[model samples]
Target: MQNNIKIILKIFIYQVIIYLNSILILDTFHEVRGYNITPQGYLSIIFCWISFLPLILLNNQKNPVMVFLWLIYITYIIPVSIIFPLINSASVYSIIFVCTINILFFSSILFFRIIDRITIPKLKIPWDLYKILIIGCGIIVLLFVISNPGLSLIPPNIFKVYSVRQHFKDNTPLLTMYIITNGGYVISPLLLLASLYIRGPIKYLLITISILISYLIYSSSGLKSIAFMNLAVIILYFYIKGTKSISNSVINIILYLFLTAGILYLIFDFYDPLIHWLRRVFFTPTLNTYYFYDYIYNNNSEFTTEAPQIVSQIYYGTSGSANTGFIGDGIARYGTLGLIINFFIFNILIFAMNLSSKKVPFELSTTLYLPFVYTISNSAITALLLTYGLLALSILLFLFPTKTNKIPL
Candidate 1:
């Protein structure tokens, strides 16, 4: 009873922090930073609270993937979908209907257990062969990057990355592009895992090389996510490795980090990084919800089936892509029906991840799973599964040796 109460209190506190953070963004930056807030009446505020109550059900301890998904949804998606829309005076009916779909999609995580009934046939590959294959792929990817658009073309700064990214996409062969992009996802996690379970200077060397390669990839491809991908995986590996409980530990860590950041900001009045983080992590991703909805539903725009970056640029007459969360992307493409389709597709991906989890360590599976979950915040579900190689990642997880021990030299 005491533990349950403590968990409940933590959940409550976490939710309050998120709610307060939304207020902080609104109150602090509404006019000064051009946040686009136009408050509706107090009744809409009540609706946001009611809409967010389903998050408590998200405290399920069974799946770490689900916990990470909920963390992003609660900390970012809910505010954008619910609070931001309300403040913007978007149609209440539209907001409620779309937000309900999001809640249902999140709640369906409970059904992921059904995936356990479908057994995946184990593949028997020698560990030596597997390592060779991963390393060989990594080498090939590096060669591809070096040859196609040599490091001489490295961008000056992250802001310049898009032009270079666009150039790479436009100039590189589609098939080669596919291999190089997907290979990064496949090889980086394996490298991180190898470094973790394997002990010695070799491990240090591997990680150092991985970080450098990530930096080079970012410089060449203009993808900021790729630059820190290995570090994120390493952090997640040790984080879950030390925890006794996965779901609660995840919630507590997120809560404490948020609180710590908030406190530091208050004490020091440090707004630059905090504002940037808020814009990236919260404002831009969520605001895309409003942008897509208004574009499609209110403006009577046709369902978009084109590249999101192209579509967003066309819509806004802007240079940058208004990359949006999956929910927003669905709305942009399919209207009300897009919501259902994206939800179903996302659940399928989760089911695949859940099935693969049986063949790997839970921590390893969840760590590998983070990128896909995180990507859903700013990419389409179709792009995530197909273009982003999440389906391939699931198969990779399923094939990972069930018994991971120290790497023998």
Candidate 2:
């Protein structure tokens, strides 16, 4: 009971820090961009504060799924709430509506008791079949990489050649390659290998090599998020397996935060070439959200063009294009109504995944769920579906379903 109270208190403190961080980021944006916080912006911040209360009050901090959800909230939703309003002068009505949608989306988790009662057939794949599946995926990835020599195997060179947004623009070939190679073949096998790492010394050595190779592939593709996501998965796996303590996890998170801040400071101080690169990756989505509203409200134009096209217009004018974050995409594609619908649907999907994780083996569940958790902030519905679909396929092929008396970490 005392431990639970301590966990709850830690979570409460973390929530406070997240709230303060959101305010700090908003103030920094205002100072840099000279955007005034309107009444709607203030209302949005209020709503954000209110939305977080349910998570805290419900008190499931020790639950891994709940912990992951809270991590997502802190990492993405909090920053997004402030950043979006700072970039776009949304009306109070729209702000309130979006906030209400967010509240409903998160609050739906309280109803997971109903979801937990639904049962599906247990899947069971043999160990031999799992090995075969991993080997097959590795071969496929190798072939794909050989076929596409344009894909760099070095991080710096890849970043030099392609902007983050350019990777997702209307390049069907590159998109197809990503879906086939990275989404389909690479991530699942890497996760499986990572899961096997805790088995023994030889397995640990082999998995380390596999992880290094996977990191190179991901970094070479200029998607730093993939590398970070994999790292998070590995860390969470250790924690789940009881190989790492909560204190260690907290320490690692703090170290990562400090390292990220130090890197950002260096980039700012040195005026490195990467300053513009980082700006384009981080700020373009927020800027585009504002431009999207400008086009719709000020220009009195309908957003008939697809999200990529709209983002392109916002960033590169008439010719170039890029993908925006899920919220921006939702708003652009369907307006406030669309955004509300998307949020609700996304929330339901995540809720189902969370419940399903409890029913499966820890290794399989972690592999299947981590990608979705990491990518939810940045990916559109279509992109998310493709990635999850591929992951589901891998899960079906490699993971044996069993009724485990062991509780989820």
Candidate 3:
């Protein structure tokens, strides 16, 4: 009874804080940073704390690996998303919708798997599945890199789509959001390789060298952020299942947190690879490091009163343009309370994922958690499945059928 009541109270508080955060056009005191943080944001923090009290009461009675698998998947979509409606922009709605859509997507995948069970007239998992999956994963990483290198979380370079500075409706800033939300490409090959190989110090060294080489000239905030994020996800999966070695467990957790601080620093730091590559692709210097801060702080107060614009730039090919603020700016919707809720949600989910992961074997757990590492690299946690290729390869575990051939088992 007490546990249920606490959950009810937390839910009520979460709703109230969410309501306060959505006062974009309604609130009179919104623009003042210090003023809005109280009623709206602070409550989110309070309730966010309240929500975690149930974890202690809950027990993991199911299969550890399976439990982690579910937890990791849920961690990505629920924690922060349950409150996404509180954000002032349509993108927040989009993020929620995306999570819903992803759930459906995975459900469809699950449904397909179930269908396979019933309609198995003649079943043959692909014989060459491992090679195909491995190569496919590498190709995916390459494609993501080639296609979306500029989709950085706080891209120093300002891209003008159709015209300059005025091409977007709501001018929905894509770069920061892209970096902040999506990171499914960077660690794909690394994780895939790790899954396929018997990992040793040498393999890790080589993988680290590859990452360093990739980011040697320009610090790949997106790639590095995403990489570490994948790692965190892996760590969570291991802990949840009780599979991790004690030292490995502590190291992974620390590595995950360290990546967070590093990515935050990168978001503030400047890097110019285009200039280095061509020696003169410089149309302009990078935007001010403090530009996002200025926009949020200066424009947030009621005194400014200007709505977000819908202009476009003629440079790229778009009908919309946007100003970049904090990609994590949605935290401000509920004020300081909401900020706490938002942060607490992330940490709690991470903890949940960690606890659940302990159910899976250490060897199997890395595959599950690899994407969390990449998520940290760029603050992109929009997808729980950070690495697109991991799925393709997981399919190969069936294709190759490593059933009784367990080396470590």
Clashes of each: 0, 2, 85
Off by over 4 Å in 3: 1-132, 139-222, 227-400, 406-409
- Candidate 1: global Cα-lDDT? 0.66
lDDT of each: 0.66, 0.50, 0.34
Output the TM-score of candidate 2.
0.68
Positional deviation of residue 125's Cα in model 1 after best superposition, in angstroms? 2.7
Give the runs in model 2 whose Cα sits over 4 Å from its true position. Answer: 1-45, 56-58, 61-65, 82-90, 149-176, 181-220, 226-232, 243-300, 308-312, 315-323, 355-359, 387-398, 401-409
Q: Could you tell me the C-alpha RMSD of candidate 1 in Å?
A: 3.5
- Report residue 156 deviation for candidate 1 (angstroms): 4.3
Q: Which candidate has the top score in TM-score?
A: 1
lDDT of 2 by residue, 312-351 (tens): 6554555555555566667767776767666776666655
True lDDT of residue 241, candidate 1: 76
Query: Which tens-of-lDDT digit does each residue in 1-409 have in candidate 3?
Result: 6744654454444334333323321244345332232223433343344334333323223422233333333232223332332332334333343344234324433432343233222224342444344445444444444454342333223232323112221332454323223223333333434443444454454354334323321222323333444455445544545743332233244334334433543685422321222111111001110122224433563212121221112222244322221122222233334334434444444434443333234445444544433232123223333323323323333244243334221
TM-score, candidate 1, is 0.84
Q: Arrange candidates by lDDT, descending.
A: 1, 2, 3
By TM-score, the candidates rank as 1, 2, 3
lDDT of 1 by residue, 297-354 (tens): 6678888765356445754555567787778878877887887777777777777777
Error of 3 at 128 (Å): 7.6
